[model samples]
Target chain A: MIKLQNIEKVYRTDTIETLALNGINLHVAKGEFLSIMGPSGCGKSTLLNIMGLLDEPSKGELHIDGHTVTRLSDKELAGFRNKRLGFIFQSYHLINDLNVLDNVELPLLYRKVNAKERRRLAAAALEKVGLSNRLQHFPSQLSGGQKQRVAIARAIVGEPEIILADEPTGNLDSAMGNEVMDILIQLNQHDKTTIVMVTHDEQMARKTHRLVRLFDGSQVQ
Target chain B: MLKNYFKIAIAVLKRRKFFTFISLFGISFTLATLLVLTAFLDRIVNHEYPDAKRKQSLYISGIEERGERARSNSGLSISYIKRYVLPMKLPGAIAFSSRSNGTNTYFHGKKIGIDYKFVNSVFWDILEFDFLEGKPFTVQQEKNLEKVAVISQDLRDNYFGKDVPAVGQYLEANNEKYRVTGVVRNVPASTYMLSSDMYIPYTLTKDDMNTPSYFGEYAAILLAKKTSDIPAIKKEYEDIVRRVPHTQKRFLKTTSLADSYLDAYIRGGSQESKQKVWVYTALGIFISLIVFLPIVNLVNINVTRIMERSSEIGVRKAFGATRKALVYQFIVENIILTLIGGLVGLVLAQLVMIILNNADLIKNLHLSLNFTVLFIGLLTCLVFGFLSGVYPAWRMSRFPIVKALKA
Candidate 1:
């Protein structure tokens, strides 16, 4: 479960201040698959980043799993994020230098998992994504669809409680996008994983259990 | 995890070949220069040679005489040593020598230059020389003004065939043919006083003793019975000097070898100026100059490296890595980089010494990477690596995660 109240995000320059998120409030229950839809420059990605604990809110409080996360130090927040939340960016963001297996194993490495277990779990995650055969293939060697699958495998490798996806299939073809949406739906329904996704695609938003649409940094519909 | 770091480091370096080359170029070149310099300094300061007992000897290199307005500084004269220095009962052996110089000798229709030094017969008694062919000339031979000499192995190889004996052969030294009585191992260079190709008895050539003066071209060395007695000998000489009855009507004094070397650099004549401080400061500056540029350049390179690697760091931080983990990783990568560079620099340093010796760049500068030089060279590598690594590591670690991902 996640909660945000009176969240505000402002971008500042030498002589100008622009509110990216204004007086926003939202909450999601456990096992819920929520999609946030917005036009360009609507602060959806910023909200996701704040929920992922990667960015700070200008003025607000965010609670995740009954813990006040906004007051946590960077170190504590990182640990909390590692154990409780996972992220999927629009571009996949899989390290080009690492093979698929190593990329999946990266998150567990920070968790101080032993090498043997890290490899075993990473392989299992890759198997779950139907790419066990591509463990040795680098991100550069993979297709757009395959890269997104690897990112999903990486996000779930540590078994985080909440998966925050920012445009998970923005670059994929419709077939590949449908395949990714199916996997996310299966995770929410079978694995009971809570998912929050930001997307511009109306069909993808309609497929989720709930839709939170934003316009000009505020919830409109 | 360390293996993983090194693996990534190698991959990253391989990925950016030109940047790696730049970093390696600076690191290797700087380390090589440091290696060569420390080796040279070791050769000058701590090498073992003909004067292997260097620690047990006291030297009177130069003497200064002052009168109302007249001032002269020179080596101790023969009569001056006899009246003022030789009477010291603290030393086990006493000897004096004229400064060494190079003289041209005719050999096989070629003018070959040879370095020759004049020393008393007691010089052989005070110093240790490894004889290769025959024994040093006797004190009786010196007393009889024998024209016998001791030659270095290198000189023997030039005059005679490598396998042939040069002892008892007449070698032309300064246009005079002196019979060689011994052939000793050539002294490795930088021993200064004991570094010479040939040694001839001073009494045989210039021992008239009646040559009377307070300041003449003569320097004395006193060998102590035990190394511990050196301080006593120095004190006894200084005590004798104070009462030597200065005929200059101005001032007279003597000094130790360390003081003599220090005074040569001092601008003022006043002995109370604490010239050692200036000497140490100059030394500090020279060392700093040698170290500063490489460190500064490496720091800049490290900054660039960290910037280029920021995305990886950002991703790691997003995963779960703390700032300490990131800093530790970067520093470890840097140390590994410089350590490899240090090894390359060491090999190149040896090559440089070989080239210098072969080209006669420093004339018998038989430099080798001694233990002290090696330790300091590696220590320099460590310090250079750490200094070059810390700033970038800290700076990169401080980057906000959201911004770092954007970078």
Candidate 2:
């Protein structure tokens, strides 16, 4: 579960000020499959980043799993993110140097899991995503859909309570996007993993249990 | 954890060949300059003095005041030697008078002459000369007569053939037949007094003390009881000489062996004496500056590279890498580079020394890998690595996960 009360995020230059998020209030309950639908530059990504504890709010109270994390130090925030949340990006962001297995095991490495256990867990996660045979292949060797699947596998490998995906299907074709959506739906239904995905596709947003729209840095019903 | 970091570092270095070459070359050049200069200094200061207790040796010279200007000479007259040097009760004190003219020639049956020195009996006790055959001339032989001599191994081999005992055989020197009392190994050129092919005793037969013309012409080597006693011994010798009836008004002085050794090279010059220290200082400064340039360049390059990896740093930070961990990783990486460079530099230093040794640039010049040099090299590498890595590591570790990710 996550809560944001009157959150404000501002970007400033020498002579200009931009509001990435303005007076936003939102809540996500446990085990919910939620979709954040917004047009370009609607601050959907910024809000998602703030909710993921990757960015700081200029003014707000942010509570994650009943702990107010807005005042936590950077080190504390990183620990919380590693232990409690997973992120899947639109570009996948798989390290080019590492193979699929290592990319999937990245999150758990920060958790100080030994190599054998980490490999075992990462292999199991990849198997769940039907990528067990491609463990040694690099991201450049994988297809767009396979890369996205690997990213999803990385996200779920750590067994975090919440998964944040920003445009997870933005780089894939329709069939590949449908496959990725099916995986998310299955995770939400069978594993009860709370996933908050940001997407611009209306058809894709219609499949989630709930949807929140954003316009001009503000959330709308 | 450290092993994994090392594996990653080595892999990265191997993968990026150009960067690795640049870093390695820079570090190796810096380290090579340092090592070569340090080796040179070691050769100078540590060749024969590292374990030598000969610091106790002192040189006795007489300063005579002639009018307004005073002239100091390291040679003492026979009278001065008899009065001051022989009566001294200093515990390990031995005095020897020597005079060197042109390089003399010696003939066995008819082979040409060799360089030689006419010295006294105390020469054997004062200098470290290994005898190849027979014993040194006795005190009685030196004090009573002048028939005995000492020859070098070179003279023996050239005149009497190798492996033959030149001792007890007559050698012609200065148109006189002198019987060889001993054969000594050639003195190393690095010594204060170079080795000679022959040594003849100063018999003091003709009562030359009364002759003021040759008062301060001969060279004297005074071996003191201890290095600490040199000043007192020199003062005593000076006081004793000045108290003599005829030489009372004259100022007599004594010099240390080091000063005499230096004066041997630079005669008629007191100003040039300071140039020795200046030369050593300049050498030290030049080597230090040369080493510093590459270190500075490396630091700048590393900082820029680390800046380019800000996003990777952010990812590591988000994965729970502490600021300490990040700093440690970078510092370790630098140390690894420097250590490898130092080893390469050591090899380079040996190659240089080998070439110089073959060329005979420095007689007996050797490359010694002592613990001190190794310690100094490692410590220098550690300091350089830590100093160069600190600011970049700090900057990299402070990246905001959000801003870095967005970028």
Candidate 3:
């Protein structure tokens, strides 16, 4: 479970102070799949980043699994994020230099897991994502859909408490998008994995356990 | 984990050939030059063959004459060595030698330049010289001012042919004919002190301690019976100097062996006789210059590399890699880079030394890769790598994962 209270995110420059998020209070229960839908520049990605601990809200109380995470040091936050959170970017964000197996093993590597075991878990995760045959293929060699599949495998390999995906299927074709959506649904249904995804598709939003819409950095409904 | 990072580092370097080339250029060029200079310095400060007893030997290269506002200095004379130096009972062997002279001889219708050194028989006892044919001129030969001379293998080969015996033959030099008494191995030009092509007795050069002012063209090398005997020798020499009624009352006299090379090269007031901070400062700045240029260039290269790899760093951080991990990865990559460069630099340094020896840039100067030089070279590369990598690594590691990933 994750909680955010009176969250405020402000972007500051030499002569500008822009409000990216304001007075946003939300909570997602354990094993719940949630979708955040909004137009472009509606702070959807910013909110997701804040929740993922990749960026800190200017002012807020953040609690993950009943533990305060906002006050944690950078080092502590990294450990916490590694153990509790996974992120899937619209770009798939795979390290292009590494092969699919290596990209999938990234999360487990930070945990100091043994190489042999990491390889096993990564292979298994890739198998679940239907990418078992593309183990040695680099990201450059993969199709858009296959790259997304590899990203999903990387996300679930660590078995984190929460998955934060920003536009997980934004760059894929309709059929590939649906396939990815189906995989997310299967994870939510069979694995009972909580996923907080930000998307613009109403059909995708309807498939989640709950949906929240944001406009101008505030949750309207 | 480290192995993985190393693999990635090597791969990444291989991926971007231009960046790798730029980094290697700076690292190798910098280390090569520094190692060459270091090797030369080592040769000068630490003797290997002839002057093996450099630590136990004291040299009187020159003397200073001072009187209130008037002062003058010159190389030692026979009078000074006999009255003030050879009389010392503590010396294992006291030898006097002339400063190397240049002369011309005809070998097979070609004019050959030869460096000539005039010395007493005791010179043979002080420094170790390998003899190939016959033996050194004896004290009796020196006393008799014998025309017999010692010639190097190079000179023997040029004049009498390599197969013929040089010891029994006569060679004409400086319009004087002398029978060869000994043939020695051709010494490298780097060995500056005893690197002459020909050797003759100082008595043959018309030398007696008849000079009155205690100054002439000679250097005395005093080998101590025991290292502890040096203090007494120095004290006794200074006492003899004090007692000498100056040929010129206005000329105050002082003489001591310059302790270090800096002292020998830099001649001045009493300050020159002791170690100065600027000497170390100059040395430090010289060494830093050799190392800093490459490191500075490397820092810029590393900065560019960090920028290019920022996304990869973010992905790693997002996956739970700590700032420490990111920093360590970059540093290791740099270390690997520099070590490769270090090996190349080492090879380059050997090549430079070979050229220097072949070119005869310094007389009898033969340099090889010793353990000390290799250690210094490797350390330079490592430190250069670490220094250049840490800053860029730290800067990139501080990037917010979200911002970096988006970039």
RMSD of each: 3.0, 5.9, 2.5
The TM-score of predicted model 2 comes to 0.76
Q: Residues B1-407, candidate 1, lDDT per residue (tens digit)?
A: 77777877777778888878888888888888888888887776666566677777766776656655766666667778778778889888888776677898878987777988888889888778889989888889888988989988888888776858988899988768899999998776555657688888877555467665666666777888998897777678777766656665555443323133223224222233344577668878888887898889889988987898777787888888888888888888888888988898898899998888788766667888888988998998888888899999999988987788887
Model 2 CAPRI rating: acceptable
C-alpha displacement of B399 in model 2, angstroms? Answer: 2.6
Which candidate comes out best when scored by TM-score? Answer: 3
Candidate 2 CA-lDDT value: 0.73
Task: Name the runs in model 2 displaced over 4 angstroms.
Answer: B49-51, B54-91, B94-284
Q: What local lDDT does model 3 show for residue A56?
A: 91
Model 2, range B2-121, lDDT digits (tens) per residue? 654575567557767777788888877777667666766554455543113345565443333332356544455675666656787663655554544444554544646566666777
lDDT of 2 at B367: 59
Q: Poorest 10 consecutive residues of model 3 chain B by lDDT?
A: B263-272
What order do you get sorting by DockQ, best first? 3, 1, 2
Q: Which stretches of candidate 1 lie over 4 Å from their true place?
A: B65-72, B205-214, B241-280, B370-373
Candidate 3's residue-wise lDDT over A1-221, tens digit each? Answer: 89999999999999999999999999999999999999999899999999999999999899999999999998899999898898888999898778899899998888979999999999999999999899999999999999999999999999988999999989998899999999999988898888999998888889999999999999998
Q: What share of the true interface contacts does each candidate keep?
A: 0.48, 0.34, 0.71
lDDT of 1 by residue, A1-221 (tens): 89999999998999999998998899999999999999999999989988999889999999999999999887898799788888887888877767898889888877878999999999998888889899999898999999999999999999998999999989999999999989899889988999999999999999999999899999886
